[model samples]
Target: MKIFLTLLTSLFLFFSCSTDDDICTDGEGTPQVKIKFKTFATGKPRTLDSVFVAVDYGAGPVAVVQNTVATDSLMLPLRVEDVPFTDIYVATSSTGNLSQIRLNYTTTSEYVSPACGIRRLYTGLSATLQAPNPVLAVETAQNEIVNESKTHLFLLF
Candidate 1:
């Protein structure tokens, strides 16, 4: 009886003191986002007309004017920093899913961004956007960690 009790206590102690491995640890690194666009996004795939690429910048779209290089083959411009994408509306220009533009000009349409501001001039929605909660006052930054059924990650921008 004494031996059995001793063994039971030893097992309980060992199990209780066991350490757990962190399975959901995402190593410390820069938080980055990839902008995925659709094929219909590239206006006039083979033309020299400017195609605006706007970034909402978490608030709304910011105009980044850039023109497409009329390539002999399937070639895409490196970036759009000059075309005037801000507030401009393209029926269906930029894509949510990234893909190469297929010409026939069926998908090519006017570029317009849904930004509300002064007429004849539209601004990106991001400009007037507001963070849900800037900071929890004094709390400044909030980071919650969980190793159970649910895990929440709050990364700083």
Candidate 2:
């Protein structure tokens, strides 16, 4: 009878000590802003041979996209702090001729899960092309950035 009770207690303790609820598996997190490139004349998609992107979150500037191959879409992460805008720099080449673009938006935090913590969401999105050289114009596609599935902005070249 004592052995049976000990086995039962051990089984109960092992089953009750499970920590599966602490693991976040839904992939709920901050979403990145998606930008697609298009030609200014034809209004069609344009593939860049070499593209470089840098953004300033809090510190100076940090490179986000440095690709040598041709690509038409880019994913950029916004600022998570209390700043209302994010400054981005795009360059067709790595040497010079960097165009500045500022992304303005309002951020809100939502609780995802215990393990995932809070995630930031942006709304009222707008873009201003401060320098127009390689990038001719900026177009806002989506006003809110809730997920990475949709294009938020379009860069006309």
Candidate 3:
């Protein structure tokens, strides 16, 4: 009867309405740069006993990695602002010597999805090592950061 039709319509309407849980699960977003440490003499991968990293995203130095144990590679997030460069300080230990590294690049925004929005892709990537001690030199690997699957920079020690 009329009551059955009204209940059916109500159920259909409730089921058809989408909720906020319909989110983007495509894993499409800003990618972090990956850096690997290597031996300066043999040019082989080297593992650090302990590592400390601080990055200046514009405001001040912020500790991103603190006392990481036995890590050969590092994943670093860059600045997404209007700046053209990011400064990072790396140390082998908590009180070890700090080496300053400046990463210079140009960014381009790409539209990923509606939920993910736009992501910044860095190009013309270059690095400068200002201090020499635990970290000696810098080598560019990929030069462009489109994804996080490959090594972007090599820190020679």
TM-score of each: 0.18, 0.87, 0.86
- Better candidate number, 1 or 2, judged by TM-score: 2
Per-residue lDDT of candidate 2, residues 10-31 (tens digit): 9998887645456666447899
lDDT of each: 0.25, 0.91, 0.90
Runs off by more than 4 Å, candidate 1: 1-48, 68-157
Cα lDDT over the full model 3: 0.90
Clashes of 3: 0
How should the candidates be ordered by TM-score, best one leading? 2, 3, 1
Q: Ranking by lDDT, best first? A: 2, 3, 1
**Tens digit per residue, CA lDDT, model 1, 66-141:** 4364311111111122333222212123332211211110111222222311112111211111231121111111
* Candidate 3 positional error at 77, Å: 0.5
Candidate with top TM-score is 2
**What's the true lDDT of residue 6 in model 2?**
100
CA RMSD per model (angstroms): 21.0, 2.7, 3.0
Shift in Å, residue 97, candidate 3: 0.9
